[model samples]
Target chain A: MAHILLIDDDAGLVDANKLVLEAKGHEVSVAYTGDDAWKLLEKRRPDLLVMDVMMEEFTSGFELARDVSIKFPDMPVLMLTGVQEHMRSDWKFDEDKDADWLPVRKFLAKPIPPTKLAEEIEAALKAAKEKKGKRPS
Target chain B: MAVSEKLKVIVCDDEPKMCSAIKIILDGFRPEVRTLGVEAELEVSLVSTGEELLTRMETDPADLVLLDYKLPGISGMDILGRFSEEKRETAVIIMTAYANIETAIQATRLGSFDFLAKPCTPEEVRYTVKKAAHHLIVSRHARLLAQEKKRIRFQFISVLAHELKAPINTFDAYLDVMRDMTLGKDMTAYAGIIAKCSERTDGMRKMIADLLDLTRIESGQFRRAPAALEVAGALAAAAEGVAAEAARRGIKLETEGAGLLVEADPSEVGMILNNLFTNAVKYNRDGGLVRASAAADGGKVRITVEDTGIGMEKKDAARLFSEFVRIKNRATIGIPGSGLGLAIARKLALQAGGDIEVESEPGKGSRFTLSLPAPGSIDLKAA
Candidate 1:
């Protein structure tokens, strides 16, 4: 199991996701803002990152995700987004087009059931592990 | 097309036969002007004398007028001078048999819109009327566009407020689910973070609500519930809402008032007092004192909230009630607020037949006095 870091400005969502991941036998830590998550990462990086796309600023989540990939390339990030419905069609995240900028193992729309969130986390962790295992170490 | 898109036109000439000719020519050019893409249609009215034209103008003025320079009773130059003197917006085109450079200069000096010679060709009349009609239409469109711009700006603000609120609602729902789960097991590990998040969300929610109220009130759509409210009760309730913050800062909060009654919406008064009290606590030095009380003014009740805190400059207090005007200074840095609280409070007070006034000295303290119509003191038609 992975030690997941849950990051969001919304305290309730952070706590709910923390509980869900903990119940699935994964250790979880939480940060309520981008600044908090940034400091936490610099101090000690978690094994896996579960975060929201909207935080203190509207683009904070994407910016932090990019920063994480630059500093800790191997840490897998699973993003939770609440703005998928409202984003303009042209401004939407295209997996192939935005891969260089948006590097996340998975992206999930918000308000998902707790069990669904836990399931996604497990799947993401397994994929990252398999990808790393095949790499020439 | 709307009625406002019609260009009212009056043709004035003493010779009925000549007036008929110009009227016929103008009527024939209506389609020609329409082809020029002028949305304003010609609304024609005929007046045979200067007196008739003057009387008709007094009742309902036309936007453009065709006046013969040689009219009985009042000369064309006299009519042009009168229009210029009164600053009427009628575009007058002078028609004279003596249409030389001197007359044209005189008419132009007297504020005539254009010159039309008698025995004028239909083609010349067509082009002249076309130009005048286009000017009227373009000016009308400009005015309407300016008004629409204002309306769109207000609508944009309202939409932005709703956009900001959606995420908060989702956050609130998540809190509800977690609270339910907390009761079932040990959730104390996240208790401190949860409390901080709860406080932050509540503050942001209040800011959003304040933003909505200001916009609705400005757009004349806010529904208010007015009643006879006891001053002590409203003051106490508002004070209680900020009591915890005051205690945490070691700031003394006090309220005292007799059975003074003010007729206003309860929620409005709550917003006003909450703004004042919150500012009192947030700006106060640690362990400072905040006092709220009311007194009887002539035909009105004076409710005052005084604070012993870092007061502001006179210039700062002058614009304190303006919407979105947060006073920025060294002492007030990082003070979280929407800056609409005082502005909304003042707006609500004025609507309820009352007003808010403030007095303060830098480094000494500040006091805000809210005066409202005392119960039955004034004719309370509506609030």
Candidate 2:
């Protein structure tokens, strides 16, 4: 089971998602803002990060993702946002083009099924593990 | 526009008599300007040379300039060319004894508002100046309106998207937890989630209603049915709506004073009261005290909602009532709010011939005072 850090400004979403992830036997911790998430990450790194794009500021999650990539290169980052196409059309979060700068392994649009969220988190964790294994130690 | 902005007009001519003649004519038109019902004041300044004119323009730019095309130092055509090149908004009127079609056409192309012969009739001066004033005011307003529209549309899209999507995001998660029976076994285990889901749905409904009311009020389309409303009844009613949440949070909710009456729409007052009430509870520390009081102060009925919550800095409180402004800090991180509540509440209050004011100190508490015109006050439509 992966230890996941879920960061979102909405407490309702944070609490509900934490329960779902915990039910699946994964350890989960939640932060209500990007800053709080960053502070928590500094204390103890999670195996994976699931964060919302819009929080304290528009690109706060992306900023946190970049920091994570620089600090904990092996930890996978998953982006979750709501109505992204409508709110921020400029940042599509497609890994093919956005991977270079976004520093995230997966992008899940909002109102996503719980199954899909869990599936993506698992896939991302597995991908990171494989990438780590290939690296010269 | 009902704007009291002064329109500065500068007259530059080498001739002293010509300067006074133009100034006297324009100055005499002031009373007639008021009589014509155009709400603009003209402040005329006369400069005998272009050097002084340029210096004064640098210090205090004139909205309109009357220049002699054949003057010494800086010819009116040369200055006109410079004004257009620099893109100053000053409307130039080129006057000359040697008025010719070629010069007039060239001046017109150089961006002069109008061309006139050396001795212009008062009627000609008045009419041209009047047209220039209209052009200046209307064009400035148009430019500002265009800019404001763009900004509002961008902000409106983002705010609407976030507000609408937040609840849906939460609702989706809650349903997912329910469907998978993540909590499992006991149906009662899901009851809290169900209730929270309902609350999110209710929040969204309130947001939608507030958005509609906000748009209608801003567009002057909101139909307000004003009646004599007793402050105590409305205050109690608003408190009743938040009683459960207040009790759950362990907040002490109380109200004082009675018999204070104001003429306003019931729904409008209810919305204002509920907004202040909800915010007081939502932002308050658990087990905090919230006191709502009403009284007649001067000729207005004032309702004050004081909360022992996480009060903001003086600067934050100043912009607290603006659109979509949520104080983002560790203290307020998990608070669920539309951020449009106080904005709409203040708007409704103002339209009903009232205003919402705030007084607060960080960590101590906050007091939001909403004042409405007492009964027998002037009509609200005047606003």
Candidate 2 accuracy as TM-score: 0.68
Could you estimate the TM-score for every candidate?
0.49, 0.68
Candidate 2: C-alpha lDDT: 0.84
- Cα lDDT tens digits, model 2, B118-146, are 67798988888887887777676678899
- Residue B332 error, candidate 2, Å: 5.4
Q: Taking the tens digit of each residue's C-alpha lDDT, what string does model 1 give over B1-383?
A: 33325779999998888788877877734532343355556788899889889999999999999999999899889999999999997899999998799999999999988999988888887778877877767676688899999998886565455345544654554565465463346777557546656665676777788888888988879777778899999999989999999999999999988688988889889988988999899989899999999998898999999999889888889999976566654466435566678989999889888999999988878999999988888776654
Write down the lDDT of every candidate, Cα atoms only.
0.80, 0.84
Interface RMSD for all numbered candidates: 7.3, 1.8
Backbone N/Cα/C clashes per model: 0, 0
Task: Classify candidate 2 by CAPRI docking class.
Answer: acceptable
Q: Which is the leading candidate under TM-score?
A: 2
